[model samples]
Target: MGFRQRTMENLVITPAFWQDRRVLVTGHTGFKGGWLALWLQTMGARVIGLALPPATQPNLFELTGLAGQMVSILADIRDRDALAAALASHRPEVVFHLAAQALVLPSYSRPAETYATNVMGTVNLLDAIRQTGCVRSVVIVSSDKCYQPRATACTESDPLGATDPYSSSKACTELVAAAYRSSFFASGDHRGHATALATARAGNAIGGGDWSTGRLVPDAVRAFADRRPLLVRHPEAVRPWQHVLEPLAGYLILGERLYQQGARFAEAWNFGPGGETAHSVADLLTKMAGMWGGGATWRRDDETHPHEAQSLRLDATKAARALPWHPRWPLATALQMTVDWYRAHLDGQDMVAVSRQQIARYCECEPKAVAP
Candidate 1:
């Protein structure tokens, strides 16, 4: 299909664009990557996954049996040669770079590893892309924490700064992508490569199968399942929380636009939830506890934890106007879906079917105006 035709179709994720496409997703063993890989696979794309083994037991990647469905490569993104070799072998036309040490508390303890994995690992991947010249569209997944702390919602043009190692590394990651886009992949480059690269900054993603420690939803699930009181850290902290599929949908749309129109869509984007979806951690836990009926309880943690932002929001107006993407599932629906998935998992049901059903349902959903 032509660029005009795609734009007329509103650049929504269509199977026609992804069918039989050669795609590579780094960090496919992780939570967001696992979902993206699965969605692409369902659209008939040939997906190549590169990352270390699953970080936690009962992770989404392994539980959904994603490894068997795609080309799963167990390798560290920190290894430059390994990344280059994998890119050369896969020769993918689309690349999604998601491999990183993706947590805040862990970054406080292991700052060096966080920088090495998030900062240098990105350097390795972009440099490897420079060597293997087949890639067309590249979307680097960054965090909303990459923005400088502020009282209002952040836009793509906001000043990028962070005090925490994880957030700082992501800020540097965005710089790395911008440098590569300007130096090597410039639209006027004479190298004959048309790789359109961009960065995606999203808000807090709460969904099923994120078994990572230090995150709110997963920690709640583990605590509630064990019949223990969940510990709440920074309960008053407010975030623009949305389902994992919200930002993933934005990434897919951005990738497609980058491939078809190149420089026109090659820029940073914010795929955050609507303003009404912003809620405090305590509020989220209350709703979750209500959904998890049998004696689910939580209490405030008094531990002196490391500093985290009390408020983080993103202005996704650029995405809403440009890519024409809007969040489909409201916070209530997102929470219900998340709780349903875990409840099914706890019952030992086939999670693969459950996960796919959610994806199908999400695809059919229309955007609704969320009430504040």
Candidate 2:
């Protein structure tokens, strides 16, 4: 199959496409991966999750009861033999490679571990996939920070560079994917074993069930729930924030295209909210405080911290034109959804049902233009 122009009407994620398909999701215990795995389950995919135990105490993977839903394998991606054995046994038709050292501040303290996990971990997965020979579509999740720091929005064509260890590792991860794609999974290979592989770079994704340390939304949720003030670092740092579902939707669509359309869709893509959604940390916190409605507050931290990017944006025009994807929820709605999820959790509500309801609502939402 070859790539064809898709209309907005058909851009909605097709549950029929994923139904009963064998899918492998690495990092299924993390926030984004958890959401993706849950969504796949809802669509009746036979999901196989391979990753270490949840890193945080109250992580989404356990909170949502995902272990009971899929075949959850406790293993590390850095372990080459284990990873290869797992892939060989499961033989998934689709793979979403998301396991990595995702946090930036932590990367400063654990640089070697970060490189080994993000860079070599990727090498392990790609090599395993090549040997396993059952995967037809692969979506490798990278970060928008893979681009060199710039004041403007970054396009997929932008040069890949990074100042921080986390970002540098992600750039190297991208290079590894590109190398594997070109060498083993090249488009239209005569050997007839080519795999359609693509990379997705997304902006700051905020949502519920994310208790990871050093994140804005989770920290705010904890502080507000505890009746304490949230401390802010780099309050003026600007990020193109969107609900987690936005990029997850992009990943699903990209995976589908890679499976059905082969080479044309096998390339790097950017999935981000519109430019108008870009806001400073302070601005986001203020809005979050108002939404929380309990006098939740934040103050700038005086302690010196490791360097972080002040401004970052992504140009998702390629995805918009090719996959015909767009942000369905605006920032205000996204923040409200986040607050609502935490409030439900605090109230002892069933988080899996709440999360599933949000996913259904997101799928039903019509694409709206970003409000300035």
Candidate 3:
């Protein structure tokens, strides 16, 4: 039997699996990383985060009160010495690297910084692993844009390419990771050196506490909060959208499986929602406006923007067949959960509590237990 067929019972991420487990999350200050860090903490894991401070003022890291939950190391991923020192000092068993210059428009202006952060930063981390010898499972989070242009859904084995600086940088990250896996962390009998490395590619991750400019969900939230009509750019651009937790869950499962089973699980994996889940930018914004409710409206912006892919989707068949993974929430449900989170924040609800509540609700395997 394949890996997915071998274990079907304990598909859920159980607290029993995470109790006292040591995890290191790079980019913990970013939107998806913050959510993953908080979720890991709730599962009773010993979590440590390595990244610069939150990029925006109202970042998820601060709003979710994640500082009290994990050890936060403020450092740049491009700094090889600092990154190596953090890894050596923390000595976590599993490492999740999500640090990168992740904005497309910004990359158009700051291409050098984007390449430095996304490409060479990956190189620095893998090199550190060569010296640290304590990590067993490493999940290097890349983007769906790493894949070559495709009319149908892109798969794990698809050719890697890039039409822009941001996408090309991610594509470079993938190549660097593959080279490291083959050269240093090769699956051999070398006991301490055999680290299993895999890359995770996911489409647009949307949820609350995303204060970044130039993102669809955050822009919609800001328009709602400011009581203005949202401006839609690239309205016809299609993307596969999933909740932040969807891919985060996939990462957690992939990490656990890599730690347990080794090289078989060490490869590129796509954690995107199925192709059917993809919708146009206008459709997504319209849905977001509906969820926000009061006087919510949007108009297409005629101003020309930076070059972004016109359409993209993913085929998560390999992940589904190999890792016992599948997206749990449908598009509407994901959108609803996202809208509910921002709404609660606007209503003066404690956002930390709200984030945890959503995590618990998603992992229905366990009732809301007393968080550690």
Candidate 4:
């Protein structure tokens, strides 16, 4: 059997199986968030987006016209009262918290904003969950940077900490999640309300509709389209690059388990490509350019290098084994699909439908979990 067929044969149950369920996404307008929202909508879920206004020009959220499809709320996760009100109003059965100050270089410049948004924003949202009393499960979207750097692959048991403000804040958010899971939502606590929570640590995700600044794919695509050489900062830096949908499929599965198993499945998990796919920044760019027709060149720009991790990857064996989650698209397929999306968008095609078509391909290939 092919991987998709094998995955389907081993299937126990999956989250996309949920139909018309009330789902709340915190950063619904962001790149990953927008993709997740679109995916959930395809699964027939009632999605509610809670986030501030889009940050940059040509945001993925607006590009896909997501606000019209779901109940979009303009609010900050840092504001405890507002967050609480939204949660209480929606009474979401599943919650995916993706809101935060996510940039690294920007974090260095505005450490306080980064800390406040990433740390306090998490605290506020978790506290809001406590007040809501109806949220059954939560999937907190964290980063591989949250792993305390060591010489080897990081399992969930590895120390939880960060080297920079952005990473450190995510670490703090994980700690807060663990505390909430163990303390209030401990197995037997009546006040705990049986709320299941899981944190997903994914590495660098690249795909279409990602117009964020300081990211590699969008920068390279724009430069190549403009017939200019792409500037490379820290070209030697290695990362665990995967398509945006790969880890996102993992999160949806985690969210499903959180609702079904509650305390039993509450933990942190990693969602990244296997070791062979992990390569340096320059390596990925070279691959991308070659696949897209070869006129692009990269120039080293050390003066503008962002404060990013030198080398980072996630061990997704736990997800693969437990959730029956494996990356559906190979690195080459991921890059090709990503490039195709940008090309279509630039050519004035319907981005939302184009994005949805990609999603359908992925879900068809998504595996069903095997019995433990």
Off by over 4 Å in 2: 1-11, 189-193, 370-372
1-372, model 1: which lDDT tens digit per residue? 643233235437766788889999999999999999988888789999999999999899988989789999999999999999999998999999989999999999999999999999999999999889999999999999999998888888899999999999999999999999999886643235688999999899988899999999999999999999999989999999999999998999998888888888888999888555689999999999999988998999998989999999888888888887888988889999999999999999999999988887787788654322
- Model 2 vs. true fold: TM: 0.95
In candidate 4, stretches whose alpha carbon ends up further than 4 angstroms from where it belongs are: 1-17, 188-193, 304-307, 366-372
User: What's the true lDDT of residue 319 in model 2?
Assistant: 87
TM-score of each: 0.95, 0.95, 0.94, 0.92
lDDT of 3: 0.85
| lDDT string, candidate 3, 1-372, tens digits | 432222234355545567688899999999988999998887778999989889898789998888988899999999999998988888988899999899888999999999999999999999998889899999999999998888889988889998899999999999999999999896754244479999999989998888899999998889888999888888899998988988998999999888877888999999887787788988888887887789889998999887889999988888877886777776677889999998898898999889987876666432111100
lDDT of each: 0.89, 0.89, 0.85, 0.82
Model 1 steric clash pairs: none
Cα RMSD for predicted model 2: 3.7
- Residue runs of model 1 more than 4 Å from their true location after superposition: 1-11, 188-193, 369-372
